[model samples]
Target: MVRQILPISALLLGSALLLFAGGMNVLILPMRGTFEGFSAASLGLLGSGWAVGYVLGCVFMARLVARVGHIRSFSVMAAFAAIAVLLSLLILTPWAWVPLRALSGFCFAGAAMIVESWLGERAEPQSRGRIFGIYTMVNLAASTAGQLVLTLGDTTGIVFFVLPAIFYCLALVPTAISSSASPRPLARVSLDLRALWRNSPVAVFAVFCIGISNGAFGTLSAVYANEVGLHLTAVALFASLPVLAGALSQVPIGLVSDRMDRRLVLVLVAVLALVADLAFIFLRPDGRLENLVMASVFGAAIYAMYPIIIAHANDHAAEGSAIQVSGGLLMVFGLGSIAGPMAAGYSMAAFGQTGLFVTSAVAHVLIILFGAIRMSMRAPVHEAEKAAFVTVPQGRMATPETHVLAASPEEAEEIIAAEEDRLAEEGTGPAHEAAAAATAAVAAATERPPRVSEEEP
Candidate 1:
């Protein structure tokens, strides 16, 4: 793995810089908007806007990458991200920041997809898993570092906004100037809700609800922290600790899911989330340490739910359809993410800081009720047939390209053909064919994709 990462360390640095900027921007916007006297309700719309733009990028950016090639596409996306960050400073209103935040989301998704495609080009089959593990670590650490860095200085100034813009430009340099080959056309997905529902109703419902809860807290924690009179450091920690806790807790949660019925694991996690919710509502702790502790539990349970749900769906998914299953669920998660913050924002308007968890508790209640109903009606997939669970690096911003980058060569070959047929119907052209075909050909011949048609100069 070390040897594999050595050649691609430059790209890893790019990932680090890009996500570091992203991490800063995600936290910066809400906190800054709050300082500027934006209401919790308006601030909450920022996350919704971002989710909307990200979903749009995931659905459409492949054609853009396919048209122009990776480097040019990446440069354009990075430039737009930097522009968006700077523009936020100029505009400085909730209404303006909301759409600018959306623009940043679109750019982040496209740029991140291009980076993952570059990494996918270089990963050897035997080393793919380890390389992506390193890549995921870089992304998570960089983003967390970016968020923590905010605690070091005042975020009310122009410098905070400039910081992310600087890193956004820096992020593109190492990869743009590298002597590496172009990767395949970026992966794309068309949402097939019926197919996803047929495969696993529990997975579909659980992920959407998880999206709501995760989105609510992820977006509004800093707002809640500010409202509660915590230090700036606590605010950053409030926003970040749950994500880190979620990432770590997934390991044991995944182990349990793989061994037993995954929905049972979902119920267990949701129950924990509920427990955290009740603690916050009733405990009403005014101390910083106490808030962090309960927030960590909330993070652990809520953050871990998506992967378990995805793994459960994979167990019921027909063979060779894992990518589509994940992609479809990703779309569902996006929609739920959009709704979560809006609901939490309104809840905050009515209920104060506690409204954030009220939104999430509602989501968890639905998941628990739905999981029970589904388990009652269906027998569990046998342990022998279950797909081994994998931790999704950043559940919030994971793109279709993330699955493409991480899957083993054999797993890549398992893509369902229905996606390709649908893309053809949209006229993305033959080069926009199945990611399976692209991955298979790349593995069999050259790892670099041969553009089947003329690409934009």
Candidate 2:
């Protein structure tokens, strides 16, 4: 047990530290851009760069892992991420920062994949639930810690950029000296758009819209807070508060989703998002405590949709094809993320800062229209189960929980039966096999004649 757990623990620590740095960088970027005299439009471009690179990295980093092996890939990527942050600190030019941000995105994706792959490898079936829980908690804490770090340091100085680098380096320490074996080759997920769309058109379409809407919010919310005369610390808190709320809200939202029609739940979420967007657009709350509450509630709804969409898609997915379905949806979401900031940023620049919410509201309007239309057209994909927000780390280890399932129920049943047969052939029952064997040995001893050798007789 110790042997299995030790490596997993190390990987978890590394992942948490990296997430901390990632969270810090995310929060600091808007303030950094504003200070560097970049226009809101340019800031949006910076976000676009990051999202584009992130999507590409997710698609191709598995190939990089296959080429270099896990440890080397991790080390090299970590170094690159640190270097990218340092470059941003030194140049302080928006144009330079764009490419640097993209590099950071790429490195972040690669490193996360490494850590998640490791977790996947080390996890056991019985322990997956607990492991996933611990992973989510650590991620939440790490991300929150990073956002709070901005309060301790002034964003006015170049020094703030170095902190993420320092934390990124710190992330490397736990994995560098650990004695865990390298994870096996990563399973590459191919995008099958036709199959995905056929399985659940609403899920495929909604993910794209959700990605665009949320990406715009994520990229510009800090800038919007700044425009409204929020203090730097307040801006940080406001930006982060929503994310935390969204994380918390997932539980109830997921539960509600499991019990009812997923599309109905989706429509409800879209309506809530629509209302939130309109609130941001029309109410334009001046830095009051009430505005903070509004932001939290609004954020909770928008951010929570992605996972629900994923779960809903999985519901309709051919039983064994969940990974491909999920992966295809993620890729669609990634594409939307790439487009979101660019469009919203330009709108904000042209129409003024409120355009951020305007853009978001418009997207949600489209989502609502499409969702309402789909309500009449499509049927439920599968029987809904209780919604649970079980987060598993994307570790390098091959944990049973994180693996792709077979695409059909027949395939699943066949695999289960085969496993049972194999165990029977090996003369082992599930769980307590050793104890059973010991008891059987005592009975055999009692039945056997007194020990006697023919030669001795």
On lDDT, the candidate that comes out on top is: 1
TM-score of each: 0.93, 0.84
RMSD of every candidate to native, in Å, equals 3.5, 9.7
Model 1 worst lDDT run, 10 consecutive residues: 448-457
List per-prediction Cα lDDT, in the order shown. 0.84, 0.70
* Residue pairs with backbone atoms closer than 3 Å in model 1 (clashes): none
Residues 164-253, candidate 2, lDDT per residue (tens digit)? Answer: 898899888887887766653444555778998898888888888887788888888888888888877778777778777877877788
What is the per-residue lDDT of model 1 for residues 1-457, given as tens digits with 9 covering 90 to 100? 5687788999999989999998899889988898899999998999999999899989989889766667888889899999999999989998998898889889999988888887876777777788888888888899989999998898998888999999999998987898766665677787998999999999888889988888888889899988889999998888889889999999999999998999998998999999999888777777999999989888998888888988899898877778778888999999999999999999999998899988988999999999999999999999999986878875356898888777766665343233334444555544554443544455543343333323322
At residue 259, what lDDT does model 2 achieve?
Answer: 75
